[model samples]
Target: MHGFAARDDVVRSGAPEDDDTVLRILVVEDDEGDAVLVREHLQDGGLPHETVWVRTVDDALSHLAASDCVLLDLGLPDAMGLGALQRVLAAGAPPVVVLTGLSDTDAGVEAVAAGAQDYLVKGDVGPDLLARAVRYAVQRRRLEDTGRALYQSLVRAAETTRLERALLPTPAVRDPRLEVRVGYRAGRDGLLGGDFYDVVERPDGTVLVMVGDVCGHGPDEAALGATLRTAWRTLVLAGIGADEILELLERVLAAERARPEIFTTVSMLAVHPDRRTADLYLAGHPVPLRLGPPSALLPAGQRGRALGIPVGGGWPAERLELGDRWRLLFYTDGLLEATVGDGTQRLGKAGLLEVADRTLRGDVETDGAVRPDEDPVVGMLLSGVRARHGGDLVDDAAVVLVGWGG
Candidate 1:
């Protein structure tokens, strides 16, 4: 108003009005003349906007609940300089543009560096300039918000990956004669579940193997699975008797589980030093498949109740005779429970046996020997399951293979 004689003409030439894109601005200015001038200029800009003027930083913050961008005068009745900016930022930090006197332009620059979207010198701004600055400030603030959100997501992803790596068990057996292979796939949620497995060779020359699944799909369940696997490894390494191991594990699960409803299904095998026999223990788990000249589920009468159930007697350990050149497969229920094709029917134990038979037949060499470098059995089984489910598994699957003599 001070520089222009007829303000009405300037308002008409600023921009075309659009009701749908009207901006709401909150102006914090103590001086009545300056406040009127700002309101007139914004109206003259012809960029449909609703302006609410406040004389103090406190009043500006109160109006912010309904306002989009804040046009703040650094010099106010209650707050001055960067102090006013700091208060506004502390209260939610919406998009902001600072108003400064021509002589205090350096302060305006500092305000921009300190999180203000943009700044303007009071005497130098026209209706068009004011509207443009407000539009650009909102855009810049949105970009910054989006970038910050993306960075946080990347950080969470990295942390989840690290946790998953820590939970996976590495084979501790050094025996070249005992070949061990494993396969694991997370569920559709893109997060690791409670499925876990471990293989360890004791000093007594016995190879201990285990595959277990806690009853859930989440970070908490995954962490619990890791704890159980670690505890089992520690007990086996410390020469804990195979007969007492499951009972001890039951105690650990009871103590460590987050809720009473949570339970774990586990299958364990302890192959003797002679590699001639092994002990099989099932805790409400699928029986281990014995791959021979014929592949089939081993005869396990009445699989034991899952761990965490109140049972007096421990899980019955059955003796398994493992002659020369034998392979045993242990896995979580996810493998057998996966849906096959587009049907509601699941790929049960029978389907798994079929897959295993196919994988073995395909992996054998013409010379009547199995390939040693790669584990085609578990790999093919997982690939087949994924293909049947259209490349998205509903649950996490884990498989471990223990073999002696070719």
Candidate 2:
């Protein structure tokens, strides 16, 4: 019944001086004599380590979790050969250095392929060899862990990009007289944010435009925003009335929301192909800016509460006389919430109109002959906001511009 020498009595030969960083080793060997020899070899080696000895695979599993490395014996009392090694590895054991007999060295090699980090024959291993094997195994395991983490990060980034593309889709309008332009900027939050917008020209010669913001910023909210936008597009395409569309959207938001507290602020506009009238609906959203003969914010009387709010209500659609020429701008609250200068004062709705007017004053010629590739007024407005903020906006921003008979 050989046993480990007392820590005070064990002579430290060439072993490195103990420091704060000590490598912990779990020795899973059935024979007490073999375990004593292995501990003596590591103590005499120049590496600082603390060893925990266990006689069976069951006992070893308990100590495996906190150990930095494992010195596992293939021939345990209850387990034998690679079966023992496979069980320890499957239990999420740390880096393993399999201990093998002279005849079973081939089995040790197989264990290495089966996920053990390294292997050493009992009779051939010296103090230095044992320490070196343990050190190398720990380092290799850390490198593999790091590589796995980086690969997972790349996969997440690719998925985020795909979701963002779906959230902000291209306008589905073919009318030459009607111009639709959109600009989007994701906030510092992440690749995907809660902002979304969509434009669609119906079969009956009517254009449906919407801009919305879910309550929070993250993957869940971004995904919810995309779902709502798709639902809106489907409803409009199916010839749902403007009033009925918002009611259905409210039900969808309530059902799909991750939490009851989450809500969405949205602005919707329906423009007739005759270019004589437009209907506006505001649900706890900002008033749209109309660049008429005189630039002003369009009045939608008595704005309704945002969707998903506990309070029940209906949003009334206000119809406006579009006259002959009009350019309308719809945006999320992030545009008006941008901070100005070094203070907390927001740019607000008035500031946004001024920015649009200033940009339009210089680009009158380009505005006369609009091309799909040319910069739209919404892009210019976003640029002004970014310049004022000194960089990206604090929250996700989305804007859609619709022009008819311009």
Candidate 3:
């Protein structure tokens, strides 16, 4: 028949005349004499505290959140022994110190093992000892909470790192004459962003490269980018034509996208085995930069609509006569959209080219063997972009530089 009490039901005492550091203590005991003794102990300790005397476990549960520490009795009318302690804990009661009778000393030990911050015998406890135990219990509980939070943060960090590695993969170029450099960084150094790129060399000696961006940021967009990138690689390896590859990729995007409004932009280009000419195809994507003796933005002629557009369109190729000593810089929009230092002007195509030029280029040695991690040009370019923006870019950024030394 016992139940929650009215707000004014609990007998309150032990609060100081004036102070904010007063600890609120909830004393859960059915015996009227023991409750009075506990309140007297709290007052005698000379500590600024507020004590709420409750008669049952039910009443204690109602006051759990308002109390800084719980002084619980092992025996209660509605609950017995550890039953009282377990219910208090399950109700999310704050730091708890179980009170026990002399015959129940073993029960007190068991209660501490179960989760009580500390335990005290009823008759033997003094005012100073009770005060010290309550303070210790509160401090210990806070440390445990902090430890739990730190552990959860570490788990999230590990997951983010794994996603970052998945989003930035190495190119699969087989030609010694072909040099590929790449870079990727998540926006705000937060969760992985929706930017992905890849390269593959065909059996016929031609190289196919691609860079793509999903419409939004965060984990969903990042996962979508991975899906599109993987599908593109599969289509290319299966010998699909560039045009058909994009069309099929659109279907993939449309099917896997998290929402109907979501879309993707892509740049797919094919470099002939001879390394003298290439065919570029853009679908609502940024134009690649032609880094020759004079670096310039390659023309994205009659661009096709971005993949997953409602009406749907095809991605046509733009033939490029990239003579000897040429490099192509392909990127997601994040690189060019950075706001200039304290201004509204964005670091657009021109700014990107300027950054590329100023950045120290670490090309492959004569041996044409540089590890993907060893490619430093892309990293420098990214650093330049961040410097220009005065901070990290607000969107996920990715860049790929394909070169041929004719």
Of the candidates shown, which would achieve the greatest TM-score relative to the real structure? 3
Span of 10 residues, lowest total lDDT, candidate 2? 6-15
Output the TM-score of candidate 1: 0.78
Candidate 2 displacement at residue 370 in angstroms: 21
User: What lDDT is obtained when candidate 3 is compared to the true structure?
Assistant: 0.84
* Candidate scoring better on TM-score of 1 and 3: 3
The TM-scores of all predictions, comma-separated, are 0.78, 0.79, 0.83
The candidate with the higher lDDT, 1 or 3, is 3
lDDT of 2 by residue, 92-167 (tens): 9999999999999899989999999999999999989998999999999999999999999999988877777677
Residues 82-190, candidate 1: write the lDDT tens digits: 9999999999857999999999999999999998999999999998999889989988888988999999989978877776655566789989988899878788887
lDDT of 1 at 110: 94
Pairs with steric clashes in candidate 3: none
- Greater lDDT among 2 and 3 belongs to 3
RMSD of each: 6.3, 5.4, 5.5
Q: What range of 10 consecutive residues in model 3 has the weakest lDDT sum?
A: 362-371
Model 2 steric clash total = 0
